[model samples]
Structure formats: C-alpha cells, structure tokens
Target: MAYHADIIVDENGKTKCGLCKVFIKDSDIYIEDHLKDTEHSDMYLQRLMIQNNIVINGKKISCLLCNQVSDVAEVLHHIDSSSHKGKMSSVKKIIEKDGGLLVLPEDITTVGSKVNCLVCDGWVEFNQEAVKTHIESAKHRRARAIVVQPLNAIFSVEGSSEDLWCKICQVYFENYIEVIFEHVDEDPIHLKNIGKLNLLIKDQNIDIEKYLHDPKEDKALCKRCGIEVPCNIDNLDRHIRGKQHLKNKK
Candidate 1:
C-alpha cells in the first residue's frame, strides 16, 4: 500500500495499549504511584471482562476506553496489549488483578490489590513508592482503545453494550476503542521535521530516521551512518533504547 511518509512513520513507530487504552509507543507508557495498595486497577480490568459498565465500589461511571462510550477520553485501556505478546493467559491474570489507571485512590475508583505490567509478566510492589520508575517507562505508559476480543469466558457480551462482534466470524469482543489524539505517534516526526527542533533544548540527535521503519510492517531504515542495512521493527525498537537515544530523551 502506497501510504504517506507521515502515516508510514506513525504506524511503524506507535501502537495502542490494550491496558491504558491509548495510542503510544514503547517510550510513552509507564507505571505510576496512583494505585499501590489497592485493587482498583485489577478490578477495572475485570469489569471489562464481560460487562459493559461496571459498578466500582458502588460508584459506576462508564469507561472511556471501552468504545461503548462516544467521548474518547471516557474510554480506558487494558494496559497489557503493548506489553503481552498475544498472550491470553497473561492478559487474564491482569484482568482478574487490581489497581487503578496510574491514579487510583478512594474517589474515581476503588483500590486494593496491585496488578503488574503484562509485558514484564510480574506484579508491582504493594507500596506506591515502589516501582515508580517502572510506571514511568514506555512499557506501562502508552494506553489506547483497541479492537480485541475477550480470551476465555463462559458467556459473551452482545450488541449495544458490546463494542464489536461478528456472529458469522464466530468472534466476540469487548470492543476496544482507539485514542483520537495521540502525540507520541507523531513525536519522532515532530522531532525530525521541524528543523530537528529539540537538538539544542533536549541536548542530542541520533539520526532518528535511521530508526524510521516501514509502516506496512515494522521495517526501518538506517539514515544515520549513511549505510542502509536491515533495521527491522525489532532492531529499530531496540535501537532507540541504546545509550544513544536515551541520552537525549528527556
């Protein structure tokens, strides 16, 4: 497919997070100190299991990431998609777990047990202070609504309450939504196009387009050293993590 350079870059660089339910990349998402000794985060994932709207601690507010809601902000995300590699068992563990969306205190939602990042395949410490850095990483941060189905359940959610379902295809889904406004997906472009903006302010430049990958797939080009080799998605993904990119990432 002949796509715009920008779109190709966007698709290759960014993705939606099933957990946070937002569009972001490996560097955008992170863990936070909001729902530490609580189950708000985990329960939120649970409600998404089969039910459309959930009653949290007796307080019910429609989710922003569920696509069932029109206002994109109202939709919440699963957080595990970008983390877990098409792993349902891992996704299930996170869904049944608990905590909040970065900030889960005593008002917007409930809190109790803590849920771990699906990518790490581990749990966060009960203390809020504990894993603050982990919460700050791109792994736990970027969240967006997505198109997906529940893994294993006795019953299935249908119609209005359901996001997207295909009876003919024999597929049912909770209907993940897509985040409307995403900056991270456009970050690399902004960083490169506009006169390479942050070089002086942020203090570094490592030939970003070198990591620019083909969006049709996650393929990338090496424009830095001027030699074009195999800079596939995974390679480009790891390329940004080296001391090179991190040195300038503020």
Candidate 2:
C-alpha cells in the first residue's frame, strides 16, 4: 500500500515508476493501483532482497551488504545511493574471482566480517584487500601448489652443462640434463629445499669469487664456518647469520 517517493519520477512530462519502468497516468487512483499491482510489488520486493541485499523483518529493513538499518520508507533511497552500489560491486568481484580459494558461507545472504580460505584452511577477513593478502601469502601459495604447480617454479637453470645438478635438492641428473625439468616439476623434496643457485650470484654479501667453490655444482664454501652451504637464499642467510661465522668474520 506504501511506496518510496523516488520510485515515481517525472520524465519529459510523463510519470513513471523508476523501479518497474512503467508509465503511470496523472491520477492518484491510477498511481495507487499501479503500485499495488502484484507484478510491480513482487519485482520491487525481489530487487530489495537480492540486488540490494536487504532483509525485511516486520517494519525494519536491514541492509546486509552495507551493514545499515533503515526504515522501509527509506529503503529505495538507501539502495540507490552511491555508497551501497559501490559495496555491492566490491562483493560481486570477490565472489567472481574467488577461484575455489575462498569458502563462502552456507548462508551467503548473511555473510559477516570473515570467510574461510580453502587453500590455507583458515579464516580471512571478508574484503578485497584481505582476500588478496591471503592469496598472495607464502603459506597459501605452497598449499595450492602442492599438487599442481612446482614450488621451485621461480628457480632457473644455470649454464648449458652436459651434467645437470640441482643445487637446491642436491640431485644429479648426470648426462640427462633435460630430465632436470621433469625432476623439478614432480619432486616433492624440492619444496623443502627452497634454493636457487643463480640468485646467490647477485648477492654482495656472498663473495662469489672467494666463497664459491664449485660453480658447476652450485656449491658455496663458508671459510669462516668451514662448511659447504647450498647456493640458495635460505642456506646462505642461515650460514651468514650463524654465531660461529659472525665470530670468525670479525
């Protein structure tokens, strides 16, 4: 029996229902009858429920998307506002590009401040920036790539040696240097040995000329610690920071 004022708009000397997009005659009876029609009423209610993310309870209308509560009379203006539309757009994008990474709640209509992550198996804040941070995290990347992508995809092969050796995993592929590709791709142990010999060459702290022993095998010798360190960020960092190595360096 009641309708929002904005639902009726005057366009070029014609009165039309903005929600239903139907022209109304210039009489109170005609406008009232059109607003009371079953089709128009159903469409208006459905739009508020779905598109506007509103929950109707008695006289109170709650906007789940924007976390706002408004009177039924003000529902149209609240939903039509720019702020509510922007929130809807952000939520839509998060759902569209989820890629099986997020575990949307069963009651999507009542989604709260957080959502579960399928990859990391943990709760993440329900927002674009929070979801992005979780997806880009190392823990999430490792979990997602456990079966599909190789963890060492960032590692690069060095030189064109006939005998290929993985300095990270310490595995030699002998004359079958090309087989190293398959080894890197399928080897589960490669995840634990997060090293790329090629990356160590660029480090100023690692005196490549002095500390490096076997370039062909990608081995680095810590003269202070008297130990062979794998040519990777993890191993080199640990060796460099060791108490004995620091003591001997001085």
Question: Number of the top candidate by TM-score?
Answer: 2
As a TM-score, model 2 comes out at 0.30
Question: Which tens-of-lDDT digit does each residue in 57-89 have in candidate 1?
Answer: 333443222322232222344322342223333
Q: Rate the local accuracy (lDDT) of all candidates.
A: 0.33, 0.60
Instruction: Work out the TM-score per prediction.
Output: 0.17, 0.30
lDDT of 2 by residue, 1-250 (tens): 3565635657588888877778888788998888889988886666546545576778988887677888988887887889988976675566445345576443324344356776676887655566677766777656654422223332233764455444446566643423543565455676444434445433324444422223354556665566767756777777777787778778
Residue ranges of candidate 2 with Cα displaced over 4 Å: 1-40, 95-250
Poorly placed runs, candidate 1 (over 4 Å): 1-112, 136-214, 217-250
lDDT of 2 at 155: 27
